[model samples]
Target: MGSRNGKILFALVGVCLLVGAGYVVAAALGPDETTTEARPQVDGAVLAHAHLMVRAVDPANPRLNGRVYEIDGGKARRRSGDLACERVYFAGGRGICMGVAPSGVDYRAQIFDSQLRPVHEFALTGFPSRARVSSDGRYGATTVFVSGDSYLQAPSAFSTRTVIVDLRSGERVGQLEQFDVTKDGKPFDAVDFNFWGVTFVPGDSSRYYATLGTGGSHYLVEGDIAARSMRVLRDGVECPSLSPDGEQIVFKSRVAGSERWRLRVLDVETLADHAVAETRSVDDQVEWLDNETLVYSYEDDLYTVPADGSGEPQLLVRDASSPVRLDRGI
Candidate 1:
């Protein structure tokens, strides 16, 4: 496995050097960019659980590169760094960053400890899209577009592959495609299976929830990490995010007969679904801000709504894409 990983990294580096050498420094970086020291206090119970909510500060200014910033209270605390990435997630007390390396061809996953100490790095395939960490921070998952991110047509249309990693042991837990799948108590196989938007169940590193696409349709898949297996739960589910209590999952659902997708929540045990109050077309993996509200990014800004399908979606943070609140109060 070491040799195989080395070869893959070698190939990724070669490709990036050939195609993205001039652009790697110009991408949006993960939240673990070099640190900046500033402490500003803000307010609200939503942000009270943690010390900082980290995200890319200047996603709009490519000239500034991927600079890391934190929201303390509600004010911006800028950090220093030029590292570029699309997203970052904190789990197991570690920061996992997914971004294109200096060589654009190499999608890299860089892990850092709570003190910002470097731990491990993986040269991955495709363009970085989303990064997620299990509640305990033992497991990390990332989604990358393997193809079809460009304007020019390609062989694969919007193909995505989700990779899970064991952060503590620094081992790749295998991609979602390798999982054995069963549908309706029978084995199911497909030549066109693609997965993305994985949400992990807390206190259980062995299980996760994700969106699986096959035969031109999408379904929510309940995955068993230890068994390397998956089972289809329901149709029309995309980007499932489990609530803090692990009793519910918020996701985006495709409306019937149209391309529009609305925010919705599902009761994992009862299989009951409720459409969130947000009626706009949202294409994001919504995050749970406490047990009642769901936060997500739409049009470069963050918005929140009630999980029970009650209240309208309201803006939380502007010019931010990834929003995370620490479970422990500061």
Candidate 2:
């Protein structure tokens, strides 16, 4: 049984490597350079209700880093400063932007203020995959894909590293890989453990949830910052984002036999989940528009659906990805 499972794991890793390589190539050969800057146009109803911070997706080249823009009161305007990123998230009054550094070869993360001015900058070890800031702007998390650095020091082609940063001092708090994990009341350790897609709890900066990928399963794990420990909650949940009320979690449910996912909402307490109205294979971490609706990017466009699993998907914004809800009194 162990040998058979091992073979399956190896096969899964190969598929993952191929997918990762394809992403790397697409990122490298980014969209053709065009003078036009991508801007987000929001639906009138959506604009009247929600304020959003989004990274514009260039029509000519959706892969290129687009300028940050804010949509409020039906007006779409570029952010004050020059902040463009591949993945972005903002909360409280701070934001995290991950993109190519000035050297152009290395990637970096920039901590910016509400005005979009970069307050601190640091180099990232690999390509940025996810970024999040706690609700109070006290801390931030980043996940990057690094090569040849699996937890067991194996010769794997790809692995992920998630780092928690203290936003106040702009210093590293700890790496998720160094934390302790428990599953089923027993210490759970594995060579293929990779962590990503962290979504901080609404009011608590120290408590959060993230996805733990190992042995062909993606488990949702609750983590503690001060304790530096995590416990497996359940399986088949990825890239979880807690609602503003923190009562529910919206995550991506992977479709079997394919690299695609469907949006699902689960009770944070009961762990019971239901699928949303969107039937497309969304690959991004979803954001809550207002607890009643969910917003996410698919194929470089942003869409919204009812959180209660009703109503059809609606196009919220065009040529936009990385949509961040701006309702946290920021």
Best by lDDT: 2
RMSD in Å for candidate 1, one decimal?
Answer: 6.8
Q: What tens-digit string does per-residue lDDT give for candidate 1 at 1-330?
A: 111110011112332342342233434344443222222223333343333444553433421224345665556665434333457677668767766565443567787666555588888676666788888788889887554433313333345668889888778988887778889999877656778889889889778999887765788999988888899998888889999889999988877766568888889998789888999988778887778888787765677788998868776666565666554432
**What does candidate 2's lDDT look like per residue over 1-330, in tens digits?**
111111112234544575365356445552343113767877655646768899988766665567898877767889855788878999988899987665545678999998889999888988778999999999999988776542333455566779999987889999887788899999887766778899999889999999988888899999999999999999999899999999999999988987778899999989999999999888788998897999899887888899999999988788889989997345
Residue 148 lDDT in candidate 1? 41
In model 1, where do residues sit more than 4 Å from their true spots? 1-52, 57-65, 79-84, 148-156
Evaluated at residue 254, the lDDT of candidate 2 is: 84
Let me know the TM-score candidate 2 reaches against the reference structure.
0.89
Q: What TM-score, computed on C-alpha atoms, does each candidate reach? A: 0.80, 0.89
Extract clashing residue pairs from model 1: 16-105, 28-85, 29-84, 29-85, 91-137, 92-137
Per-candidate local distance difference test: 0.67, 0.81
Compute the lDDT for candidate 2.
0.81
